[model samples]
Target: MFYFLPLLLLFMTASPNTAIIITPNEHTFRVHQRAQWKILLPRDYANPFDPDEIAVDARFVGPDGRELVVPAFWFIPGRIESEPTTRVATDEQLRQASFTVRFVPPVPGAWSMMVKVRDTERTQRSAPIFFEVKPAPPGSRGFVRRSPKTSHYFQFHSGEPFFMIGPNLCWANERGIAQYDEWFEKLTSNGGNFARIWMSRPNQLFETKKLGVNRYDQDGCAFYDALFETAERHGVHCMLTFNNYRDLVDRDMWGPAEWPNIPHNAINGGPCTRPTDFINSEIGQKLYRNRLRYIVARWSAYTSVACWEFWNEQTFTNVDIPPAWTRDMARYLKSIDPHQHLVSTSFGANSQHEVWAMPEIDLAQEHQYFGEGVRDASAPISAMARSLWEKFDKPSLIAEFGIAGEGSDIKFDPDGIGTNMHNGMWASMMSGSAGVGAMWWWDNYIDPKNLWYQFYGISQFAKQIDWINQRFEPVTLAPIMSDRSQPEIFADLIIRSAGGWGKSHGKPIAVLPNGQTSLGLPQYIYGTEQPRYRTQTILNVGIPQPTKMVVRVGKVSDAAVLRVVIDGEPTKDFAFSGLPGAPGQTKVERHPEGKWQAEFHQDCELEVPAGKHVIELRNEGNDWLAIEAVTFRSARSSQYADLETYAMKNEASGDVIAWLHDSESNWFNDRAKKMPRTISGARLNLSVQSGKTYRIDWWDTWKGRVIESREITATGGGELQLEIPPVHRDIALRATRIGS
Candidate 1:
């Protein structure tokens, strides 16, 4: 009862009994629209779910006879998989499946494709099938890239700078699809053009799935179909990220990324013994290439799919040495994709090894976190962006970042994790990253906190910037914090003198009737010079040091000894010898407990490790000693910029971008608390021509709107000043040279 259509039967499995179906034997599609060629066959003929075992390609011949080969992957419709264990596709339901390639014609006119299917044992070909294509809709320029313009920015194939600014959104359940739709629609309504769609891990994949190992499921593909359709309608582009590290996250026997949950694991009756094994094994390579074939054939046709990122933080996996694997797979992707959409890989670590700097990557990607350092998250963000943007000298992206802690302990604040998500985007933009930093924990943090507005604000700022035509370079600026006498002074509010807080300082302390009062921080007591204990000192004295040194202490804890860390390394039970006496005195003292305690009357002599040293005096639980005085036998060190601020000028146009950043907690959105005027007054100091008139526009980080404007003439050739407005969050500015 079956009819044989051999003339155009370009692809079929090795088995002669199976049937192959090609829909729309003839076709017509507009440019940038998909033309799907589907080949269906019985399960006996090929492994529908095994991309490694089944490979197909359709070589489309343009009007001028230029053939562009596009691959095809398996797809079969099924319902969404949810909680409570269940199976959607029965063996009979998977008997017949399809290999599909949805390609959008790059150019309009008459076109034809020669379909080819490669089975494990044989290859089958189909005769030419002709089609016609039309021009794309108005206002559509196509996929993003950096070709045709060698600038440090991403531009569409049509050469418009694609300054992307959006969150990393993975697939949401049906109930949440509406939310996603609204998010995408709103983003477009406010000028956003880019986002990242994560494929998630094995058990959590919403875009790709394996139905009982040998058969594929179409539900994931269907979700993307509607997702991409909606994206095209809203003009939102997507960065389709492949397997995240969670795929092989085998921390335990059963968890979010358990081995049994991953169908591709060797224990699950598939290829590769471990998570890292898949990256370098031959069988793993085949499976990966097969997935690429499936993805490239299915999604490459649409301009909406911006780039195919192979891995999300590859280093997060056991594959610590993954650069080679990255290079291999990246090269494979480059060899297959027809549209040549960008190809990139992100590292969980702040930076990539030199191998990542290879040409295979289109974007130098990095992820950053805050709270560990004394500075705010923005400082590291701005540094990572500007650093990689210049070092790679290619387009760089802060693919993932926020105020979360590192590794498994990462915390996501449903309340928005302070203004970190806000500041990260603005800092990244002005720091010269190819796009505003894409926020992670999209569903939990971005959506719930309504942080998407930050992108809209970033998009607004981006629209005003002609990053495509006018390239810029970040300029070195003066330190945000000039000088520091003591480590504690850098704190927002320091208790230097115990005379209680001065009246000018917010919330004055209570004064006693006897004309004497105590500040909450005893160290702040005036005149008496109450000691501030538990301090750290990191220095680069820049000179060689002797084997012994002495420290003088004005205050002490009779029983408890402090820890003195040296040369960036910490040492415990560092008893002050209490010898060499005070800076000007000489004496030795020992307490009843036999532990040497630093005395005000003597210089506490301690052995100084040779070479450069960074000293730290930590209180061992008790109020041990104060950093009232330190007599380092070596020279004193200089101060580092509390913030890593920089500026860049657009040569073609006289406009400039100044990025100033601080990683102070007061700058963060903590427990929904707002920063006070004390957190204000941050500034951007950049090199400018003296006497030149410049129009400066202060940017609001969260709102992405201008807060104020001023015209200032540079007073010197070395640097010029622009004050940060009184915003609780980070700030940026765009300066245009009017005249000299």
Candidate 2:
């Protein structure tokens, strides 16, 4: 006698009739916990990863009599191999073929499951297995979800607010899982709860090598399993990023290489001949879908995997990601993933409204890297966060952020005083972002410098408020500066140009050696037609005195030179000498022969009198140099305090959370002095409920605790005035309404 269920039957294929053995890891499991079963099918089949050849699925009936179907994926058990320097472990594969079904039990009840194997000839069903699920323990908040009450915040299944507060743990270095273990422990201990992880480059779990076509790297898979397990243990939610633009491009900012090693290339007997082909071709889509199926099957059960980001800076890819591609891929991914995790993708500091507006992209994301011309890093973060939130009316994420795009600022600030890292975190949170700005350079700077305390401080402060139900809106603050004679310097990036490989006069030009071929350049320089190697603009010097102009040049090739011509009179040539590293050096490594030896020099300065004059920057040497950003110093300095304020108010209850930042107390300004000028007497004025009493707690952003407290009542004027305490760099304050 055989028992058959209609919904449970998936696919049947041809194969030799053989016995299927199923062994349960445990007969019972707790709700929200992973329930797995080991399965062995004794059948000889070529390409077990191909569903056309072999398909395996697990079907289960929950306590509510609802049927749930989950796919089964190949898994090979492995041991960890530790790297001596960082102790980051990689997988040492063991040769054994097996399949497993992993699922997180949703509810507490008795459930029954059956495994079905399908092939061309016949479909075989294993004996049904019964299991019990116990209720989850107290304080166990389920997976994160978009709060039903708010558009810009996240909440757990239990309706508790989940404010993400951590940096990007993109990939591990030598320390691998062990590194994550320490990192997660430090993060969670500091009250941090989120991390953005990339599934590309270094230790990616996908099939990238030629021999691994249609088959995932078993070692990589095992590494991820351990990584996720470690993350879950630390209670850190991971934004699992799938692909990066670097995976498709042959050359990037790092320099020339053999990117043809990927399995998708035509040379590897795959479907795509060009990078764009993968997004346009049917076969490529099919291949991607297969990979997605395997990914969801293997890792969807882990609650730690919060969001599924499709790509990291997708616009940087050689082929632009069409909205249809994102729409179709996201739709396909959602269809198979029973968990229905949040889906997102990122761009290079620009919003792709067409794609982000789609229902598939749950969150709008961008990566922002500021140049040296930027005074305060957090200013852009706050501006971008507010722009994204208001434009799309959705939660936003600054997925990758840093002082410089190329590398960590550790090379600049060797003392490791993380001013940019700290300010960016508080700024994003207060600026209506879904979470703190996820900073980049984790391995080289953040982790090594032990800056987990910054994340901890944000986390501690976030725990005091209800982000989901508060319905917080940004509040405009009126500041009363105590110091009226503080000299304020007006700084701006005067000349911004991108030099690499771009079309010039309808012809392709490679100005810088080892530059990315697909890199885009501005069509017109400063609104005037100009060649790629040169830019001309009229400088209407407004100040009455001489202004200092600093030309920051980068991406220099051998024998490259830059000349500034003012009023048709050319200045002395600024020559490059053996690519001396400074300003933008992320790492110290010798360039391979025949490739470009790039240099970073920011000391080229020129003084211009206050008058209207035409200025031109021309590459006069045999090679070329990129004008990254030209900064100008104003001769006239205004008197004002450099303090900045951002606040959010709960409309329903007059509660407010605010932060005050000393704009001048930044890494660039204070790194050498190692001191931030303390500001004494200041006042904050904001509107509140008239005649309402409120209690304010001023928090120390660095110490992660309350430094001062005060009680006040709003008068009939409806404006509450606060006497700001002595602030060094920045401070957080929470004003909660007292009584009804």
Candidate-wise lDDT, in order: 0.59, 0.71
Name the lDDT of candidate 2.
0.71
Candidate 2 residue pairs in backbone clash: 13-119, 13-120, 13-121, 14-119, 14-120, 14-121, 87-175, 88-174, 88-175, 88-176
Q: Across residues 514-595, which tens digit of lDDT does each residue of candidate 2 receive?
A: 1111112221221112243243323333444567777776556544556777768996567763344533543233455443
Cα deviation of 57, candidate 2, in Å: 2.0
Candidate 1 at residue 174, lDDT?
43
Instruction: State which candidate has the highest lDDT.
Output: 2
Instruction: Give one digit per residue, the lDDT tens place, for model 1 in 1-740.
Output: 01122331223332455445577533558776667776765434334445446667788899987878887776554443332123444444344446677776778899887878777877778778777788987776877787556557888766677888787776565454465588787677666778888776422343222333333335555556667777877888888888776666776223446445555676766766777666677767776776676677667877788888887766666676467777887888878888888888776753454754788888878765443211234544565666676677688888877554433112434355445666667767777888888777666556666656667666877888778766687645444533345352211111111111111111223221111112111221111121332223222232234534444444454433545566546564544334335343233466554545444533455666555444544445343443333333432223333343446676544578765544344333354464432344445565666667888898775566788999888785735676666544356678888853
Off by more than 4 A, model 2: 1-20, 81-96, 122-128, 483-640
